[model samples]
Target chain A: MSEASTPTPQEDERIKETSALRQALIRPELGGIVGTIAVFTFFLLTAFNSGMFNAAGVLNWSTVSAQFMIIAVGACLLMIAGEFDLSVGSMIGFSGMSIALLSVTFSWPVWLAIIVTFAVCIAIGALNGFIVVRTGLPSFIVTLAFLFILRGFTIYLPQTLERKTIIGGVSDVAQGDWLAGLFGGKILGGLFTWMGNAGLIGVFERGTRAGDPVVDGIPMLIVWAIVLVIFGHVLLTKTKFGNWIFAAGGDAQAARYAGVPVNRVKILMFMFTAFCATVFATCQVMEFGSAGADRGLLKEFEAIIAVVIGGALLTGGYGSVLGAALGALIFGVVQQGLFFAGVESSLFRVFLGVILLFAVILNTYIRRLITGER
Target chain B: MTARSTHAPIIQMKDIQKHFGSVIALAGVSVDIFPGECHCLLGDNGAGKSTFIKTMSGVHKPTHGEIIFEGQPMNFEDPRDSIAAGIATVYQDLAMIPLMSVSRNFFMGNEPTKTVAGFPFYDKEYAARVTMEEMSRMGINLRGPDQAVGTLSGGERQTVAIARAVHFGAKVLILDEPTSALGVRQTSNVLATIDKVRKQDIAVVFITHNVRHAMAVGDRFTVLNRGKTLGTAQRGQITPEELQDLMAGGQELATLEGSLGGTV
Candidate 1:
């Protein structure tokens, strides 16, 4: 029996190699990323004539997306860890509203009320996590109930506001500020402002320069988003808490058997997600200089879509925070590109549907390949 | 029993009965496992083999049974309780995450902690070092501890699961069909590990349907049939044919042999 096709000649290394490669690519999270790029390329080819690649196009849509991209990043971590928080949309409104109501109603200092508002948000987020983990109910149910409860209470809050929002003291964060320069620094150049979508990638990169805006370059909100993403990524990839998140999501029973406090991990993930949502709402409210109830509507689905597009699985076990950031970036591009291209906004829904469908199909195909069931 | 077998039985089951709804999974099943002995439990499908192991591992609240450990009679309420009592079961499928690094999968929930409260901090350097050390102790030479458990052959996963239990204070290890899904080489590798387990003085309850494998490691054999114990035999007391004769229910095999015109 020569090495040439001897019967069952043991080491058929090719089969093993192929299966190994298949396993890495088949992961549900990676599937999402590969799927996103595939669909995005197709859209680019078909819609290229729309000038979505131009600066004004980038300016318009990216500004819109950056708002959600900030929150979607956190939502990705929550989903990948096998939990959900539906109250995030509510958290945004409540956090923004709470900050405004506190400053206007109590005549408290702007900075003091802002700090207190976040503290409260973090606590509430933590509470949601604690309850879900202890009760063993799906986080979706828990957070949804949290949403209805918050919504009912939200109407009562605006009564304390002068214009139901536009509170005193913190207007610079949203509207514009000259006093902002006294402390905000000289590097805060006129065109270098973070408030304007006209900054680089969004605004034609040449024209659309911010004429006059207060809170200036690297608005407190954008700075918070970047910091949160970095921290969230570290929390997910480098710590024991991170591993526990994967284990709990991957196999709850086995995780318990291995001594993981699965409930605790789940609760923390939920709370963290809600906290991010609140921060998002607060930041957006600050940018526009007012807290409105209508803010963050439908953002839950968008955040989930971002996560799925980033390559995180809804079923849990595998995901990446960085991938989520990329996913959010993709959304920013498409949305901005379409707006500046002057394509009908209604057609945007059609694009979303197509991209969503493509992402799922490619993700499933990749997962199947990974399992060797394809 | 040899003079070397004089160590007290690590695990002793007495009249253990388990019922799922109305189905009798285990009926007065009893067995004693001594230190340094690879005690084999042989059964066909639906022979209460799983039920018997579940009872020992605290997965089942036995309707009626007494589990004696270290000579003290007790009952375990959950799998965690069983593990705490130094009892661990390795299922045929090997409960380990395939996508995780071997070091991570090895530690899972019991991750070596750098800080002890309000949060868990992974001791990455410690984990990597200990994982490799543990693998070496189990006679597994690998390229690195960072390799995923899924990449290892089937036999390697089984060995890792067993080593994990032993490393974590498991005095009595229950292996559920560890070699059943494995290839020939893999089966031998597991069998060799069982021998290693015996030399380490940890009593083993090896479940299998293969007679040759049981004969290879077992000093004592138990045959279960239809949720009941048929009989038990020492290695010196029965031939391979005799063991199968008992397992198959001699009368049933005889009738089938006669019906086949002596082909058996």
Candidate 2:
């Protein structure tokens, strides 16, 4: 009688209580962490005595990694929102040319030119999003169209106005320009000098500026990369909107049923992608002292590859900013490490393809484990 | 019935009709839903059950008739308007992202936030705590709030959706085929969840074609056939077989039986 009258409990035997170790294994950042360590160890072993760890060599790869980081953060967020922006590379070229045309050719204040360039580029980004949302077209197609249009305009606009695909004299016009300094100038020079005097780092042995540290203050590009990574990570993991992004990418119909503004989230992510591209373009033009029509060729693919290696699903709905940043670091290290180890630089592409395949396989296995699907 | 009949209905559907061009989906169906009562809407496939719920939940505007909600004549422009008016519909799909954690799915669009140094954070601790409490209240003791919704049983997922609606102040809950895809044990758990929801004084419109499942927790049963409600009957006044016959069309079944001959 007591057995028949026993009350039913809510807890079921089917739901497995996960352990802390198992939970950590399921994190999206696991592959990135392992890959970063593996890459660093490989480089350190092969390129240790080739001055690859020197101050200048470290900066070389870090700057390149920062470029990849800027665009990867944007791509990572957009992928999580269930969309793609293929126009990012062309946008870089277009934004640089626009900044040059406004500041140098038109003789506008460098600050105004930079601000106007940002506004115009961001508007174009918004237009990309608008077309995608209003027409219900895939963002891949819409942004692919913009990629050609922007690249064409980038090449055509300079040739039509100045009879050249590359614009020069931008650095001369930008000298003493306060806005230009933010992009091009380095910081912490005094600290570097102090380090040089204290013999903490290599110094100029027999140059006009002797006893100067080989590496000076950090570049604004790296600063911007760090800032954007922190911002993107915080926004993607700690805010209510982050949940909406996951929902929108995971199942858009479900998100809408729950009252999420999916279109708005997707559009904003596209705009953010454009914004990141423009930041990269501005820093490139400032550092190089000119803008070329083919400046950012294939950078969009590089950013997407970095994100993929960082463990984002190509189908969208799952990823991490920290993982993407680590993926960028691996790219930077391997690209520069190849040259340091006396290997052909072109082999970098081969490495990217191989690592990308491995990461995707790892991510797929993790996905299956999480979902319990065959 | 004595106490419930005295209380005015929370939602009154007066002669509601819906049409898809030449096809009439719901034809002049009227049902009054009282608070704390389980109103089971029983109907066979293509019998206007979906259309009727869609019209009631603001997914479609009726071609004719008015919806009186809380003594106010209401015309919901869309699902959002109905949701804002305290009507939450958990459709068959449950509108849940399988990859997300149970807490995340519980508060998908309506996440609770707490200001931290002037910045609003997603208050995950509070959300997790509340999700655990609410799930247990609905008779589902989840392993943890972080368990992915995909890993949960169908009945557990339904409980999560229902608990979410209740926590969000839903006055009337419309569940479309909540137990259709569940196993027998899971179906019983869901029916028990319905009972728990009703005890909270929230009106539940349990839509299903299964007579046995409907009879488990349903206080009143309304059967529809060919775009019209045959009738509404109170508990103890109707049996499971009667409800099944009404859903399958009593006269139509009799004629079908006669056509089959009396041997078997």
- Pairing residues by index, what is the TM-score of model 2? 0.95
Quick one: best DockQ, which candidate? Answer: 2
C-alpha lDDT score of every prediction, in listed order: 0.73, 0.89
Interface C-alpha root-mean-square deviation, candidates in order: 5.7, 1.8
lDDT per residue as tens, model 1, A1-374: 36764432244344544555654665545644664576468557866767555544444444555666678777877786678778888787788778767765676665666678778888888888888777878888988998877765565667544545334345744233333222222344465444354544332234464354422344454456567778877777778788888787777766776767877787677767777887776666555566776566677778887777766767776677776776676677666656555668778778777777776666656544433343
What fraction of the reference interface contacts is present in each model, in order? 0.38, 0.62
**Mind giving the per-residue lDDT tens digits that candidate 2 earns over B124-145?**
9998999988876776767778
TM-scores, one per candidate? 0.76, 0.95
Kindly list the per-residue Cα lDDT of model 2 for residues A219-322, writing each as its tens digit: 99999999999999988889999998888888888888888899888888988999999999999999998999998999999999889888888778888999
lDDT of 1 by residue, B153-213 (tens): 7898899988888888788889999999999988987998899888888888999988889
True lDDT of residue A347, candidate 1: 83
